[model samples]
Target: MSQRVIAPKSRGFLFLDSHPGGCRRLVEEMWRAVPDPAPAGGEGPVALVIGSSAGYGLAATIAGLARVGIRGIGVCFEKAPGRRTGTAGWYRTAATARLAREHGRDMVFLNGDAFGDAVKEQVAGLLTERFGGKLDFLVYSVAAPRRTDPETGTVHSSVLRPIGSPHTTKTLVFDEHGAPEVKEITTAPAEGDDIEQTVAVMGGADWERWVTFLDGRSLLAEGFTTAALSYIGSPLTAAIYRQGTIGAAKSHLEATARTLDERLAKTLGGRAVTSVNAAAVTQSSTAIPGIALYAGLLRGVLGDAMVAPVGQLTQLWDRLTGARPLDPDDEGRVRLDTWELDPAVRKAVAERWSGATSGTVAELADLDWFGDEVRRLYGFSVPGIDYGAAVETDVPWPSAGA
Candidate 1:
C-alpha cells in the first residue's frame, strides 16, 4: 500500500485495513444461524442462483444447501469481484461443488452471461440432464454493470447518477480512507431503451425469461419459487438509488415480480419474492459512485449488528425453508434488514455523524473491522493462506482478487 493510501483522510484516520480472521468469524456466525441441512442427499432439491459466487448471492446458495437441504447448481458470471479474473465465479464454485458432492449433495456450476438466450438455454439443459430438469427455487442476484444484447450486440452500461440535474456527492476510493471527500457525479436520465436495457440486465427480464424457459421444459416443480433481489433505500439515497438508471431497472424488477408471482402461483403453485436487502460493503456497492462514502461513514456510526449482509441471507434461507415469517403487506417491498434499520439504530448513527470532528476519527478506527472484512472477502487474509505462495493465475485464483 502507498503512503498516501495509508495516510489519514481529512478526519485523520488510517484506511481500515484487511482482516481475514474477522471475515471468517462473520461467515461462521452467519452459518450458525442457518438451521443445519435437513437432508440434501435426497434425489435433488435444486436451486439455481444466478450470481452465486460472491457477496450475499453466494451466501444465499450456501444457506440453501448447507442449511436448508437443497442440492443445487449456482450460475455465476464469476469474475472475481473488485478485480477481473480469467475464470469466473463458477471456477471457485467448482471446488465448492466438489465438496458438496463428497457429502452426497450435488452442486453444478455454469459460468456465462445470463443475458444471452444461448446461456439461458444452457442452464435449462444443465437442469434437464443433471437433475431431472426440475428445480424448487430460483434466486436472481446478478450484479453486472453492463450487458450486451445478444441480437444487437449493443453493450448497455448502467450508472447511478441524478436524472435531471447535476448532482455532487462524497465517495471514498478503494484503499483510500475514512471520510468521503466531495466528488461531483452526473448521469443522463434513462431513455426509453435505456430503461428497457436496464430492465433486461438488472431487472426481472432475465429472471422471468429463466423461469419461462424452465417452466416450458417442465423443469420447475410445484411449490416452486423464484426470487429477485432489489434495493429501495432512504430519501438520502433517493437521487442515486430511486431515480438513477439502476432504479429504473429496479422499477421493472418490482413490477415484474408481481407478474411473475402470479404466473408462478398459477403454473407451479409457486411465488415470486423480491427482497430489498439492507446495504453493506460489497463489490457492487463499492463501485456505485457515492455508495462507498455512505458505507464508510455508516460503518463508523453503526454497531456491528447493523451490518446486515449475513442476516439478510439467513432471512432468505428461512423463507425458502417454510419457516413462519412476520407478515409483509402487499407492496412486496419487504425489508430484510429491518432489524438493522430500527428506529434506535438509525437515530444513533445519525447522532454519531452529527458529533464527529475532523482529525479525530476514533469512530472510523473502530469500524475498521468492516473494512477488514471486505478485504478478507477476496481471500486476502484467510488463516493459513500464504500470500507469498506462487499463485497459479493460469488456473483460477482460488479466491477472488482482493
Candidate 2:
C-alpha cells in the first residue's frame, strides 16, 4: 500500500484519496446536465477524445456516455501511481471510467503521451478491434507544457508572452507561505523564435496529424465530425491572451480547422470545426499569468452566467448532435464563449478591472470563490469531505481493470 501525503499550498491537496466524493459529485453533475435525446431516438455517435482526462475533455466524455449513450475512447497523459501519490487527473480518469461502466457504456481510456505516433497507431488498432474501425466524432482538448516533434525529434515548449512589446499586468502569485497574492508583473515581448516554438507546442499540427492518420487508415466513420477547442478572451486581456503567443498558436489551430474541413469534405464527406470556449478556472488556465485575476473579475461580473468545464462541454454536445444542425460563426467556428464576451458582461468586467487593486481585490472580485474553485480542481475544498482523515494513495484506476 502506498502512503498519502498532503501539500501545504501552491499545488493544493496532494493526498491520493483526499476527496473521492468531490470527484463523484462532478461526474454526477455532468451526467445531470446532459440534455435528453430528441423524439426520433437520438444519434448515438461514437467518439475519440484526445487529452480526455479532465476539464472540457472529461466533461465531453461524460456527456457522451450519459446522454447520448455513445461509446468513447479517451486518450490522455496522466501521472501513474507511484510510491507517494498520483495526479488529480489520474483519479478523475478512474472515476469517469467507473461511471461509464455503471451506465452500461463502454469508455476505453488510453493513458500515454498523445503526441507520439505510437499512441495514434494504438488508438487505430483499438478502434479496429473494438469499434469496427469507425469513429463518429473526434474531440481535441489537450493542454500540455511541452511537445516532442514526431518527425523532427525536437522538443518544443510553450510560453505565454505578449507579441509586440513589454506589457505590465496584475497577476496572482503564491507567497512564501503559499497564500495567493496579487502582484504587478511585466513580461517581455516574444522574440527570437518564441512564436515558432509556442506555435509548435500549442498549435494544430498534432491535431492535423491525428486526423490524417485516422483518415488514411479508414478509421473514421463516413460523415464523421471533429472539433478542436480554443479560447478567445475579451479586449482587456488581448495583449496577453488573444493577441499573444498562445493567440498565434490558436490562429494556426483555427486555420487547420479549415484545412481539415476541406479534406474531410473531399474524402469522406465529414466536417471539422473549432469550438471557442468561455473562460473558466481549469488546471491549465490557472497557471497562465494574468488569467487568474481576469477570471476572478470575470467570475464576479458573470456570477450565475459563468459556465464551468462541464457546462461548456454539455453545450457543445447539444450544438453538435442535437435536433438542430450545427452552426458556426463568421470564421467557421463554433461560438461557445458568446455569453462570456457579451457586451454588458464585458463592460462590467472592464469597469471592475479598472478599479481593481490589491487592497480592494477581495471586495471587487470573487477571489475567494475563485480560489475555492481552483482547489476543487484538485479534489480539495469540496463539501462533505473530511480533510484530516487518512486516505489510501493506491486507488486503482477503473480503466486499468481494477
Candidate 3:
C-alpha cells in the first residue's frame, strides 16, 4: 500500500485513477454532514441499497445508517487496486464500512456486477440469514452506461441522444487553455435501436426484477418502503435530458414505480416510489451533456438553495421512516427537485444561460466550484488531505465476499 501525490489521470470527464486517502476523506465528510446515528434498531429496520458506492446511492446508504439507525446491505461494482489506483467508489465504500462500525451499525458490502443474478441471489441469501429474512427499505440508484441482462444474457448500452430532432444548446466544453467555455453544441437525434437500448439499460426493468425476486422469497417486510432516485432537469436541459432517450428511460422507471406500488399495496401494504432529486455534481451527472453547465449555473443562481446529495437522502430517510409523511407530486413521485425547479431559480438560470458566452460565463456561472467538485469526486483536490504524503493505495474493504 503505497501512495504519493496521486496525480489526476483523465481523458475528458472520465477519471482513470483515484486517491485512497482523499476518497476516504470524502466519505468521512459525507458521514459528518448527516445527523449522527441513534442506537441501532435491532432487527427492526434493515435496508438494501443497490448501486451504493457513489452519488445518491452512497449518500442514501450513509443516511440510512446514520439518520435512520438501519443495518444495510450495499451493492456496487468497483475495482480493487493493483498496478494503478482503484476507483473512487471502492475507497469510499471501504471508508463507509469503517464509519458504520464506529457508529455500532452493521453493513454488508458486496462488490460485483449488481445487474446479474449471482449477486442478487447472494444478497437474498444474506438478507434471509443475516437480516431476519425481511427488508424494510430499498433504494435503487444504479446509473450505468451498459448492462448485461441476467435472464437473456444480452448487453444493452444507454445513450444520451435526443429522441426526435437534433437539439442545439449552449453547453460547457474545455478550451485549449484547459478551462471551461460555453459553446453552442448540437446533438443529433437517436437512430436505429438507440432509444430501445438506452431504455433497456437505464429503465425500471432491473428495479422491478429486484422487487419481484425479493417478494417471491417473502423477503419484503410489511409496510416495506422503497425509493428509486431519479432526476428531472429543468426546461433549460429539457431537449437533451428531460425529453431525450434517457428521459424515456426515466419515464419507464416512474411507470414501474407506480406498478410496484400497486402490487406492494395489495399484498404487503408496502409502497415503491421514485424520488426526483436535485441536480448535483455526481460522477454520472458530469458525463451527461448540458448537465455540467446547468449544475454550474444552478450553483451560481440558486446559491444556498442548492441541496447536496446527503441532505436530499437524509430527507428521504425522514419520509421512509415515518418521521415525515410521504409527499408525492401530481405524478405520484417524491419531488426533491422542487427548489431547483422554483420559478425564481429557473428564471435566473435561464437568464444566465441565454447570455452566457465563453468570455462571460465565468461571471454568470460557478464554473470554478463545479470544476473543484468534479475533481473532488475522483479523490483529487480534496481539502485537509496531504497530497504530497504517502497513503495506502490498497485499502482493505472490511466485509466478507467484498
Predicted model with the maximum lDDT: 3
RMSD to true structure for each model, in Å: 6.0, 2.7, 1.5
Q: What digit string (tens of lDDT, one per residue) describes model 1 on residues 281-360? A: 67677667656545655666565656456567767767765674624448665568675467775675556444434333
lDDT of 3 by residue, 177-292 (tens): 67777888889999999999999989999999999999999999999988889999799898888899999999999999999999899999999999999899999998778888
TM-score for each of the candidates: 0.80, 0.93, 0.97
Query: How well is each residue in 1-402 modelled by candidate 2, as lDDT tens digits?
Result: 764445424443223333444555666666767667322223356799998877788877877676667775899998766754567777778788877776667778998899999999889988888777799899999988899999989999989899989989888665556555678889999988889999998899999999999888988888888999999988888898889999999999999999999989888888899999988888888777788888999988878778877777777777777544579876769988999889999999889888777677777788778877788776777677666665666767665342
Q: What alpha-carbon RMSD in Å does predicted model 2 have with respect to the real structure?
A: 2.7
lDDT of each: 0.63, 0.79, 0.88
Show the lowest summed lDDT stretch of 10 residues, model 3.
35-44
> In candidate 1, where is summed lDDT lowest over 10 consecutive residues?
1-10
Give the Å error, residue 30, model 1.
6.4
In model 3, pairs of residues that clash are: none
Off by over 4 Å in 1: 1-35, 79-91, 151-154, 174-196, 353-367, 391-402
**Residue pairs in collision within model 1:** 78-88, 78-89
